[model samples]
Target: MKDFLTLRLYARVARLGSISAAARECGLSQSQASRIVADLEDGLGARLLSRTTRAVVPTEAGAEFLARAEAILDAIEDARNVVREGEDLQGLVRISMPSTMGYLEVIPRLTGFTELHPALRLQILLEDQRQDLVRDAVDVAIRLGTLSDASATAQKITTIPRVILASRRYLDKAGEPITPADLTHHRIIGGPSGVAAWAFEREGEKVAVDLQPHISVNDNEGAVVAAIAGMGICSTPCRRPRPEMLDGSLVPLLTDWARPPVEVHAYFPLGRQTRIAARSLVAYLKAGFGEPV
Candidate 1:
């Protein structure tokens, strides 16, 4: 088999077009580079280069061999990078999260982390569907609500208080509902799980109401937008509180009757060795969103 060092020196010499120039690029003396090339040619039993006083040029066989040598060196370098990235804290971490969380929470904090770790890279995958960690090869996933699986390890990052909201325009056009009973007559936007019938507690008593929605969406973010566009009232988590609520676009309808808070979590496979890049990213998120428990 051809030696990697010899092949590298041959490629460098071909690129620089001179032994002396290749020597500088390879951090070797000109004589050392020349000898390496000669050794390579001897190993292959072919004259790889034709040298003149002014310049060195590749022979026909040398040109064909140089192409192969360049490819080999490139592959070796790529393999090295993959191994280094896997072993150290300095590589890419693939992470996935819902669109709203990615846009409103994760993306903002990632900017600072990226600046701090120059070699670390983030591959963010945003989707409304719950990601399968092992199947998708994701390093981490941020999810909301109580985790159903007992096997996967999770850290509670934050809690989002649920709120009831409606656009001012919608309320003005269709009239506001004062009580849970009044919601039946008004249009409401529900999410993928449909209009969840929440039981609210007041004065130490629980009251259950089945919600009816005019429009139902697969994602909470979509429901928020629909509610903002004067579609209908929506019961959503505070993490994606209506922008209108902040800027006077939307207003709370029934504050006292809102459901209990929901929790957001960062989940990963149990007992897996957490990569440094993934750990750093999680730490940054916890600092911004509150520490993981």
Candidate 2:
């Protein structure tokens, strides 16, 4: 009989589209994972994955096998749950979210969660870049912007308002702009898109401004630091840096002119059977974070 563990590993590799990522998830070395997959292909006499420098994609046979593999894993979990029904919630629940949000929002409240489920293990991965739910083995994810993946199920956590901000020193130095048009003249600290266009609305009227910032940073924290250092003004989600605002390190700008709110969502992998522990945690986050949908 084929080893069920090896089959589970193969399913994870196909889902994540990276041997290294799957290796990390399965607690195996990258070389070992690669060799195992190669052995499976040889045994079946079919190529399972097309590997490139950037990513690994499943072949037709591999894709077909993946669906069945997932089903088998799900069935196995269901069986295990039936056996462990009387015990406390115990197992790992991996989560991914934006680094800044994790620090400002989730991390502070993590102890409360751990206290509720002492036997459960929480693995939180903080990253600003997007992550694949299956590939990364993340049971749940907190996303700030639009979700393009149709394969995942999402629940709205709250709507985050996008707002412009500046340090008092920077505002004093450059003078605060009264209108969106005046932002063009000041030094702007920006992100990857780098001084791109921003939209503002008030009283049912919208205006777009093409801003050219003096400094460009690829990280959210970096932009916040730059703005606080009086480098320039910054645009960020309103929920962040509450302490900074309270302590007078950062100040809001253009409050009367409204910007569109960005939706915050909690997404789980599609088709995979979610654990009772994971479902409970998601519910806790929804209630704790903001206004729920």
Candidate 3:
């Protein structure tokens, strides 16, 4: 069990690139954690970590061992869960997701999951960019849109309705666009897709417009913020901005037209090697979204 604890600390160190951070997380002094890791190296007869002025990183041998160590720890947890079928789940689940989705969907719906699995620890990493899940030690990621990577193991969760939106202040000044083509005359505040190739369909007719962005932002939340401030008309997942839209801070534009829904998927970076706690979290999310278990 002591050796297992040491392995857990090492895994955290590699993931965070800091021995001190791992020590803090595991409730140990920096020197004690350092000594444990050194003893682990002595036992294995290999230098697993390389310490630098800024960060402690895994060596080539350490990277190989880290993967095995994670798998071993997961297996031990799985064994324990099998024996304690009715008990709360254990171990840590590191989840990756976009800022908007995390705030609007996952975070709000997580209380029940946490309560049910009180022993389980959840760490959510939020970003708008595609993250290197394996390198970052992410168990699961909630990815939006059609996944470009075929190598990843992905499960379709749900789709979010896409819509054109703008603040009432801007629409009152620029006038509401009655048609999809009318958007060409308006300033388009870009969302994640920086370029404006807005796609819309209505009654068997589809219009694809390629308009340059008036102003751009990398994140969906940032674009929504810009639109709320009357920067320009923006595109986003309808459910995410529902609060602002309901409060009359923003208005849905061109409601007559239909845009393709954004795909929401559970992306497992580690594929079949993903932890049970991670899968359980994904299941909880699916149920919250009204999907069949």
TM per candidate comes to 0.64, 0.75, 0.91
Instruction: State in Å the error of residue 31, model 2.
Output: 6.8
- Candidate 2 residues lying further than 4 Å off, grouped into runs, are 1-4, 15-24, 29-59, 78-87, 192-197, 201-210, 271-276, 291-293
TM accuracy, model 2: 0.75
Estimate every model's Cα lDDT from 0 to 1. Answer: 0.74, 0.80, 0.85
Residue-wise C-alpha lDDT for candidate 2, range 1-293, written one tens digit per residue: 25677887898888787899889988999999999999999999999899999989999998888878877766665565556664556666888988877876777867767887688788899978878787666888888767776868988877777778889888888898999999988998886434388889999999999987788886667788889898999887766545778798788888899987777788888878776666777777777776321
Window of ten residues with lowest summed lDDT in model 3? 269-278
Q: List the residue pairs that clash in candidate 3.
A: none
TM-score of candidate 1 to 2 decimals: 0.64
Q: Tell me how far the alpha carbon of residue 94 in candidate 2 is from the true structure, in angstroms, after superposition.
A: 3.2
Which candidate number would show the highest lDDT if scored against the true structure?
Answer: 3
By TM-score, the candidates rank as 3, 2, 1
Instruction: Write the number of the candidate with greater lDDT, choosing between 1 and 3.
Output: 3
lDDT of 2: 0.80
Evaluation by TM-score, superior candidate among 1 and 3? 3
C-alpha displacement of 237 in model 3, angstroms? 0.4
Residue ranges of candidate 1 with Cα displaced over 4 Å: 1-88, 239-242, 270-272, 291-293
Work out candidate 2's RMSD over C-alphas.
Answer: 4.2
Q: Which stretches of candidate 3 lie over 4 Å from their true place?
A: 85-87, 291-293
Query: For candidate 3, lDDT tens digit of each residue in 3-76?
Result: 78988999989988998988998899999999999999999999999999999999999999998998887788
